[model samples]
Target: MRRPSTSILFIYGLAITLLAFIYRDPYSLLLISIPNAVAGIYLGYRRAKLIVVLLLLSIWGTFLNAYFLANHGQVVAVLGPLVIREGAVRATAQIGLRLLAIAGAALIFIGGAEPEQIIRDLEAELRLPKTITFSLAYALRLIPLLRRDYSEIMFCRRQRGYRRIAYLPGDIKTLLLPLLSIAYQRAIWAGITVELRGFRKRRPRYRRPRIGLVEALLLSWLALQVVLPIMAGWTM
Candidate 1:
């Protein structure tokens, strides 16, 4: 089925990612991440792939760190320069699970949600400050414009044989002034657009969405993820 509410999803995702750090046991971290991973897969397969890739990288990094840098406790294996320790394996699970939980939590917010929609929802429902709402709304719009600008600038740089950073963002180091000039012009236009709209202190009110049974069940699941782990003394 579809997501019930993005606002609830945002809060739930943030809560899990933040609270994940409180648990010490790897199994507890794994437990908390499962529901998020499951929900993400069900709701958005495409976006879920990104999270899966990130989790894979984290797992790889954790094991690499364990194999190379982790040098405590009893030796489990030896392979020339590589020394595998029992503690290193434990550390790998701890760190990898933490990353897994964090990545899984991300799915709840970004997996199936649009940036503009999220901003609008928060602005209408949460009543965020005008400055914050306006900035976020405009920032999202600005990204594609900036990318186009960047492509044009990079093209010009290549014509000039500017090999400073080789297609990386650092290539902008010398091009900063021109980019700033473009940005300044864009800001001026954005301000004019806002003023024309008569954006003011009075914010239009939005009716709150009624939560259905599915959302209520999701809320309960979110609570249980933390509560049961804490009850089991799996906290750091």
Candidate 2:
């Protein structure tokens, strides 16, 4: 199937995230996310893997924090109905499912989208300011370069017999400063290159995007997912 345009995907992703926030019920959130999760798996398994990892970490962290706050530093409560800790569990589960929904939608929409294409669509279809669009595009383009640089840095460190320690603080102390410096240098170089190229004066002409049946159907489905729940009083 032909993927929807970046603009439509972006909008749909935002709508899905908004729905996740609006609906507090964990089951409702999970139900809404199922379609997006299926789409993400079908459309972009490689892209979805990173998101899945992040989602797991986020859920664990949120659950721990919520549990601590609910228990007020007490031990874990016994598993029983009508307990105060039950509220914490419910809250944490709801948050985790909500995050899952948002991440799944992002994987479905942005996993296959090119930064250049999104920039073009924003500039052309949304009539966004060129400066904003170009700046965002530049940052997005730098992500892969930064990832490669990080790998190189790690390789160099290993070559110098600098093995990573088990402690998180030690790891951060060893890695963070060097990575920050590299990022700063790259940013400076990118700024200079853009300035020298007269980036401000260059006007990029974008072709208006055509929306077809596929896009229309996708949008309709997303609309139903969000709107029907509220209309039926399933979500507040």
Candidate 3:
């Protein structure tokens, strides 16, 4: 299947995530997520195992936090068709499913997006200013570099006989502080390089994207997902 435009995918993803937040209905959220999940899988996304693990963990954590940890000493209330414990369970399930739906939408949109293409689309279609587009593109491109830098920092720390202590705050201070400093330095260097090259004065050439029937169909499907739920008064 031909993929939809990156911009359309991004907008649709955002819409779905916002819908999930608004509805907060576990059953409806799961149903709505099916198309996005299928689209992601069709686009060659192979993170089902990871997504399943995360979903299970999120459900467990959310359930514990909502029902036991957070509501430990609170009085249970009797709502229509549900008591306080049941309400909490319902809320936990809704939140878990909503999160999974959001993740699925992200996988569908972001997995197929290229930083350069997104920048181009934002600049041309959305009329974003060049500075904003460039900055956004640069930030996206920095993710892998940041990961590599973190790994290198950890290795250096290990080589210097640094051992992780039991205290979480201490560990964060030792590890995260250096990583943040490195990230700051890298950002500054990138700014300096851009300035030196006078990149801001030049207009970037963007590849013009072609939208076809496939894109229209995908967009229509996403629109229906949002509209049908609203029409059916499914927003919980």
Q: Against the true structure, whose TM-score is highest?
A: 2
TM-score of each: 0.63, 0.72, 0.63
lDDT at 122, model 1: 62
Off by over 4 Å in 1: 66-68, 112-116, 128-209
lDDT for each residue of candidate 2 in 25-65, tens digit (9 for 90 to 100)? 65568777777877776665563454565466577667667
Model 3 stretches astray by more than 4 angstroms: 1-3, 41-69, 72-88, 146-185, 202-210
Per-residue lDDT tens digits for candidate 1, residues 18-70, read 76787777768789766666766665555345356436656766787776777
What's the CA error at residue 148 for candidate 2, in Å? 4.5
Q: Give one clash count per candidate, in the order shown.
A: 0, 0, 0
Winner by TM-score between candidate 3 and candidate 2: 2
Clashing pairs in 1: none
Could you give candidate 3's per-residue lDDT for residues 33-57 as a string of tens digits?
A: 7666666655525423334434555
lDDT of 1 at 87: 79
CA lDDT, candidate 1, residue 36: 69
Worst 10 residues of 3 by lDDT: 44-53
